[model samples]
Target: MPDRPATASLDNPRYYLQNFRSVLRWVAGHHADLLTPQEAVRLAQFEALPEGSQALLVRMVMRKGDQFRASKLSYTEIGPTTVALQPLVSQGWVDPQPTLSLAQLFALLTRAELVRSLQAPLAQAGLKRNATKQAMLQSLAEASPQPAPLAHWCPGIADTVVALRSGPLFQRLQLMFFGNLHQDWSEFVLAELGHQRYEKLSLLPQSRAFQHRSEVDSYLQMQACRDRLDAGEAPAAVWPDISRSQAPSPWLESRRARLLFSLGRMAERAGDSTLARQAYRLSTHREARLRRLRLEEQQGEAEQVFCLVSDALKAPANAAEQLGLVRIRQRLGRRLGKTLERLPRPAAIPEIELVLPRQDSVEMAVVAHLSRADAPVRYVENRLLNGLFALLCWPALYAPLPGAFFHPFHAAPADLDRDDFIARRQTLFDDCLATLGRDDYRECIYQRWEQKQGIACPFIHWPTLTRELLDLALGCIPAQDLQACFERLLADLRAHRSGLPDLIQFWPASSRYRLVEVKGPGDRLQDHQRRWLEFCLSRGIDVALCHVRWQASPTAECET
Candidate 1:
């Protein structure tokens, strides 16, 4: 590691401010060309904000919390007044009074450590955790008004509660970091499970959500118990009873199977063979069955284990499970057929590049060599980001194009599917194209980007980019290609923006580009990567998946 500068210290508040400056300089130095006139103005105004506001801005940019309490902002370095944000407020850069409710707070707390620390009952005969949480919060609220301090449970509870009640979330993240708060359907849906748990109802048409908050609480408690059992820490006196619980849908069943699998692992780690097998036998999850098979093999209970694995094979199997099944079959010496031909290679095939684990460095090296050779060939990884940049600007050019809704920083619609998106693409593309055709579209893009004019927006990762690269993306890349990629990305923004190749080889003179996804040895295509590859193939996008093999001495591991 490099030596730290003598002047740098976490104790100094100014160090944070200096970090803010460093971040701003990086953004300015990289995306300056992509910035529209209005964006430049907005960014300049942000830089000139009061020192405290600047500090607060950096705080929001760096953390997961959306809203912040005025009290939390009442520090010396950051101005005491949330009202200092009036400039930002007027420009829609900040929502000073975002709405939040008690129900929301309870939902958030159920998953939080405070509830876990309370040693709260999961299945209290007829009661749910939601009821318990609300009752507790009600007590706190009642206590709050009596001029007595409420029992503060955690370090950040007061700040969190205050934020939930009336704090502001810096909603206009695209202006600051070119993205919005974390907004993915999976995350939102999973978090929302707490709400369904509170309501004690199943979100079956929904997934991840459960009928009881106790369901989650019990899972959490069991996980804790498992960890404690493994680490030799003391556990709570009581535990949640899974059998006495209400009838479970498949999702809950799968979740419980996972928990049982975890318990089996903990028991195995603790050297409790009987307890481990009991947990394993109780679980429907395939991995648990595999472990049971192993244990039964060790105990010379071959018949019991074989019957168990054979029954387990009835359930749906993913790639990993299938591999496990194959391994178990091999262990039994029954795989004397074509199944052996389909097995994954145990080592790298010596036919590719010279990277061992990952090709990130090799890809960069290859691209760097081409760049140095000056063959008009440059590596552009974010050839896709340009498409995102264009999509983000659409709402500005076509006011009705859903700028009131969609933006780059924001995730695309959760309910929206690929077919629906493609069906509506014509009208959207027309409006965006119309917007881009005008000489003033530049101003529109800038204003929208500056003011954060949409609910759904694009997010840019600023660190791995440069101004020259962005310029090349916008100028040298073909507009048609950008449009094609943008349409594909919109088909399912959650799924499609990923899986792009590690590097792109671009010919500036011919405006031609080829994608190269470098793989080292045992690397295989992930689901998302496969999705991207399929899209590229269908669209005639020249893409190659290159596998690399590493040559190393037998003592390489010892050397390391």
Candidate 2:
């Protein structure tokens, strides 16, 4: 207690101009009156401005009752007199005491280097004044000389200014700068000492612009798959591990399901029946959950069942729950017998087909046969059958496969030759049907398109159908052969001629080339298709789908 440190007083004139310079620096880009006495004192220490100079500067900038009032002025008369002398002290030329002239002050203030040197002290002095006054004083201290702009007091201070101006803080600083010049400058000085980036201060999470959960999940899954592939593991073996290892997140369920489905397709393509089966099984489970959610939504359930299912699926030891889930599905099927009956046969063979009974089921029967088939031929046959199946299921005006019906054809306009057109249309329909009934449906379909139009038909429009067919074919063929076939198809499409009809028939028997009229109604070809098709056609390849109109009913008049 006896050795308590003595507080420095502001009465000494030796430190007066130095303190004044400090206050001016603090107020440069901020308001003055907002500074508290304690803050002013801290700012003075921060800028290393002398105590007496800070007190003098504060008194000169702020009137009584302003922020600097708390630090009572010990040399009030001397404060204004020193401020008037500031210009002279800044120039290194001393102003004689009696005739302190404004011209001499101006001369002193105009020296750019001297003014910059004076910045540190002014900034410190500004901190001691009321927050508002301190800021004004700081700005005046840093003002540019008439001939040359004021040099930045610190080397990187310009960068800080640029950053502050470019950032969000610029607007706030501008407002504060022009508003109450005293308070804002003090706050700015405090902010600088705090090393805070005013622009980056955000309160809202939405402003962060983070990636969506699904996107991130999808990327991770792909990377994991690629990593596995790089490790030389078969695609089929890698999928299950990838799916099982996924992090639990409701928003990522759909992405996870898609990844699993892709892996299943890859396994099937590689002729890894066991691996393919596993992947498909995982995908089907996810699909089933999605279907259940859709059903619940339709029934107006209180909570979205899919969200709960996703949570359950993400739980530890998820595989153990499979048996219970299957039993639940069976019970549900029994309870909703009529509803189950009305459900359309899944267009593609699912991985879980073996688990279900195969009576009158298209996917199960096809997939079961595909698993037993061999090599390139098996792959080709599966693709052919699946493609036909897809066509049958598709609700087009004229479907080539059995069990498909054409919405009644409308008669052409009276100006056109209706009879001739009808005969041609009838022949085309008959040929398509005949191809479907052949023993080698794949060759037949390909032959029909190739013989007629010298081009392959569009398959991308129906991704689900393509995926299903590809999976089945992969089960039948060796992975290398399957990949080659896919490449062939892609190459053919790439080399096909432009303006060729949309549908092409490939008949291997009678003619190697034929045109099939195919159309993806309301579907636009993507950039990939356009480029591929253009390349193929440029290479004299025959493949194209022609745009066509179909009448709604037999009684409706035909427009084309």
Candidate 3:
């Protein structure tokens, strides 16, 4: 088998990956009625595995549930090394592979997570428990790779599941599309509850109590509604119809908010202004309010929005929110001479020391030339292999918010010690970093780049990433810096990851780098982006937020 950069799946790697991704997408689109977003994701990941890995996966999968003992996966067919499976494990195609250790479990604990993990009796007894992680680290190594039962291994390929029959609604959907239900209960529950607390949602045979009650989730019930709407079903037929016997208690709080929000969206799309307005008023979410305001302007109900803004102006607001109020007043009543509050003068920060690019893709064009003029530079927007690298190096760092896997992303626990975080992270990184970076640290990232770009990709795989882009990113972005940057991103992805500077330029020959965030005219820094800029700039990472001002629109004849 070829070493790290290439998988043993196929000989013509590029052609195979492209064709496979295309075919997967085609199947997903054609069977849109038959799959959930998560199920479609599983199909792509499962098909991307190497033939040997696929065979080995069948062995492990046949024997256990979603996350079985990783120790059971050291098979002869896959490879001589268990590390070969890390790509699958890292990408979340295989539950990010857990290791058995006390410290690892500790690293995953939040106080909320801790309280939730143990009962009141046990919590009280163990709340004061302590350990020397550094001392514990010296003696421990990764749990050894154990052989899966060779007897359990099936000889030939299993029957290709083409159609799904015996199952629930979600199951039937997955079977028709991806051939299996890849979503586990944890993920399903997480989706249902969102950032709220975790509670299992199950269906029971309808009873007198359940006549007006809903044991099933509102979101789950919405599936068929969305499916019908997408299939060109009329809005009246597609919207859920609650029977007279059904309980009014089912839609409460957030459930009510979600239903009203969904109703407003559907009503607006169906051109029912009256119904949309009613639904929008009942929704508690800001998104619903914004959509309603936009709709009001569209339907000549601007007076309502104007009244809303006028009444709400007594409270504090941001510049963006204030500007929105200004627009509402300006456009109200269609009187050209009618005046409202003047627009606030937006702050402009001049970049006097630097010469900004005039090119449309200033970031890309500037960096592409700078790479040639000086050294290598690469654009890593969503292709954050370094972030994945950090995760791959330390799966325990996933430290999901106590039962948070089934809901929206949340911040890591605040009470974790800085030394402890570094210690736990370094301990995990140390386990494989040496072997991965033995010959060249650049190859370490490059190998992960291959995995992320290859079959182990978790999501809808990106358009084929180029070798030149890979080479420069691997060759330039320092591996040493990857851990620090990724740790910060993970520490608070909501704040840190998005709004990052667009380009990272590197002078590999001199071991130097700079981060550049390019902004078009009239674009100011977002709050989250400004946080990243401040963090990077304070750390002396040479980050620049470049706001581009175009001199003039280039004539088509002068276009490059």
Q: Which candidate number would show the highest TM-score if scored against the true structure? A: 3
lDDT for predicted candidate 1 compared with the true structure: 0.48
Candidate 2, 1-560: lDDT as tens digits: 01111112334443334433433342431333433465456444534543434444344343322121112334644554445334323431222222212222333232443345455655655543333433534455565333322223333222110000111222222232222122322333333344321211111222111123343335445556765765667785665457565444322443455556666556656765555555555653334343343334345333344344445445422222443343344445555452333433322211111122223533233233323223111213123422442232122213222211111111111111111222324444344444434455455434433232311123222333343344443233332332333333322222221223232233333333322223323545443344444434444444343333333554654232
lDDT of each: 0.48, 0.35, 0.46
Ranking by TM-score: 3, 1, 2
Show where candidate 2 strays beyond 4 Å.
Answer: 1-222, 227-233, 243-246, 284-560
lDDT of 3 by residue, 218-290 (tens): 3345545555656776656644452213324432234445555676778788788777776777666345665
Cand. 2 TM to true fold: 0.18
Q: Any residue pairs clashing in model 3, and if so which?
A: 190-406, 190-407, 212-247
Against the true structure, candidate 2 has what lDDT?
0.35
Scored against the true structure, residue 353 in model 1 reaches a CA lDDT of 42
Candidate 3, residue 237: the lDDT equals 68
Deviation of model 1 at 495, angstroms: 11
Clashes of each: 11, 99, 3
